[model samples]
Target: MRAILFVLLLLPALCFGQAAKQKDNPITIGTKQTFHSAILKENRTLWVYVPKSFTAGSKLRYPVMYLLDGEAFFTSMVGTVDYLSALGKMPEMIIVGIESTDRVRDLTPTHSPFWASGEPANDLKTSGGGPNFMAFLEKEVMPYIETRYQTETYRMLVGHSLGGLTALHALVNQPALFTSYVAIDPSVWWDNQLILKQAQKALPQKGSAGKSLFFATANTMNKGMDTVRVVQDNTQGNHNVRNSLLFRETLRKSKNLAWAWKFYPEDNHGSVPFPAQYDALRYFFNKYALDKDLNDSTITVDYIKNHYRAVSAMLQYPVLPAQGTVNSLGYISLGKKQYAKAYQFFKMNLENYPTVGNLHDSMGDYYVKIGDKKKAMEAFRKALSLEEVAETRKKLKELEAGR
Candidate 1:
């Protein structure tokens, strides 16, 4: 039954691969999916990036990060996740970039025919669609992704500029929608500081939905001005920086939320997202890396188990030991002629990943080492039934011939 569940989990990857072959060797970083929205009455395009390490039929589930302004930042975000997760700085997570159809209409929370600098403009007619956009996310987009993907309950929201305003809007309005928020260069100056005022009041209240937040503002001020001077400037042209500083001050009363803020003296609005995204991910998963080496003979199974339990607690999800890590330990133990240690490692891996056919094949190798022909044949057969590995079949035939 567990093996069947494992195959079911791998089925999406296998099917995705076969369908992708219909394309003629195209270079791709993420897959574009269609999301039909009932609230918005439109079909939206969604960009999804699943880590390559996760496509191998493993049962490992990942937290999902919903990125706003995906059309601009999707590729860079994928590279950041790939680089950090490879070095064990953070866990590999699924990234879903929400591509926008009507940028200003979807991201802005209120309607005003004026710019943040308070200049009147005629192009703001389609504003105030944030409520519908939020509805589309919570009622349609999120449910679609959650139902189809192997995701944990912990979710992160990321955005910049107008998209950043929407990120804070979600936190202020629908606090439980995402577990954390990354609002880089957010336009709290929108609607004449509507969201900024609401956040100031709501963010300080007890049991506020925003449990975690990372706020960042770029150096959009005058060349000589720093964050302190910009806040006191009160010039109409200094609206964005001023609003950001005011919002940053909200953290003083927001002791209930785990939060951080930064002022990038070097990066402007166009460049701050890159550094802020990197820092925000590091902050979220600061304790994800294991302290001890799993391959060391001195470490026991109990330590590995406890380490991942701590990881699960930090992530607020049920994270299990990765099949690859445990398998490496098993193979290393086997190389040292430590059969008992090898057996323990293999058992620990198989217990965590029952649906993995590769683990069953490894177990057959261990049974053969112990000179148990009957058990070896049984393990090989079971391994073959779950996954058709050539080595498992070859060993099974040899055991039968010996009989």
Candidate 2:
């Protein structure tokens, strides 16, 4: 009888463990979606990475990063953003990686008979469809993503190789589309430096006051030749390096836009994107870091508000401290018995995220700690109204019964 009872007792725990594992197994990092494009006249598969903080009903909206060469770069970019945002080096963002059907066709701005090496570029016969591709993004992709996802006004565009060429093309021809541009080892030598020439003329005329760009090139010289030697030698193989420098100089002379460039001697074209993407993101968000000495005594609601207000001005959109940040700070204060500071942080979060049930629940906990039973009940009631979770409902019932 004791053996049977032991087995019966073990069965419930085993079943519960299995159920918990089953529930957790289906959780994913991100999701894949398909959208039919009227402009491209085909369906495109998109890889999307929503931040961990994103919830279905939350009022929070995130900036979106549209990555080119999605099949190659999507996972790396998602990992990079996820890691950095967790460190607060940058804000968590939504990543949308658009898969390509015909890369050369979609990435090249002008059709050319000769390659960057001045050889007959027969492989680019169907090139010069960049305008149409941009149209597809502007008309179809952006709208579709905005409709389906919670996105803010700030958007970033990232590309590599042929995709880098397209990113530069967009910057020159359509500067208003993205807030920042990152082009890694871009093939700017296409069509005898056609895009570079266009950039020299168009970029100045367009007035890139609020725009930011970071472009980098890898060492493409012969084994013996350095950057200076390759430029002086001007070999066909040097066309890419030479044209990229010219493009950089042209933009520098324009002097209207915020731009930065880096050359990696140790990294070649294929290996450059790994570090380049990380650096580009860091460079664009360089001002996002908070003062390191900040502590519970120094933190104030106005200081937090003002910091984000400045961030809003820089990003051209209203942004606030993440709900998680506020909640964590609130709890940290409460744990230290800093009731006033804890209440301030919690109240600020409630003001920012009025609809979030957890914020109300946290505020109730804060009130209870400060021995304010009436306010605690009010907060608990608010939480129960927003969500009928058992713990919150039980807390409310206990409070009511005690009265």
The C-alpha RMSD of each candidate to the native structure, in angstroms, is 10.6, 5.8
Task: Write the residue-wise lDDT of candidate 2 on 152-172 in tens digits.
Answer: 999999999989988898888
What would the TM-scores of all predictions be? 0.83, 0.86
Best by lDDT: 2
Measure candidate 2: CA RMSD.
5.8
Q: Per-residue lDDT of 1-403 in model 1, one digit per residue for the tens?
A: 9999999999999999989887658667889999678799889999999887676656667889999888788999999998998887788889999998887899988887788777787787788898888888888888898887889898999999989999998888788889999999898888888887888888788575336888988888876767778878977766678888888788777747888888888898999999999999988888787776766678667777898899888778877776677787888888788989889989998887777788888888888888888887887888888889887788889899994
Distance from true location, Cα of 329 in model 2, Å: 2.8
Least lDDT summed over 10 consecutive residues: which range in candidate 2?
A: 289-298
Residue 202 in model 2: lDDT: 86
CA deviation > 4 Å runs, candidate 1: 1-24, 51-60, 86-88, 208-210, 235-239, 295-298, 336-339, 367-377, 391-403
Which pairs, if any, clash in model 1? none
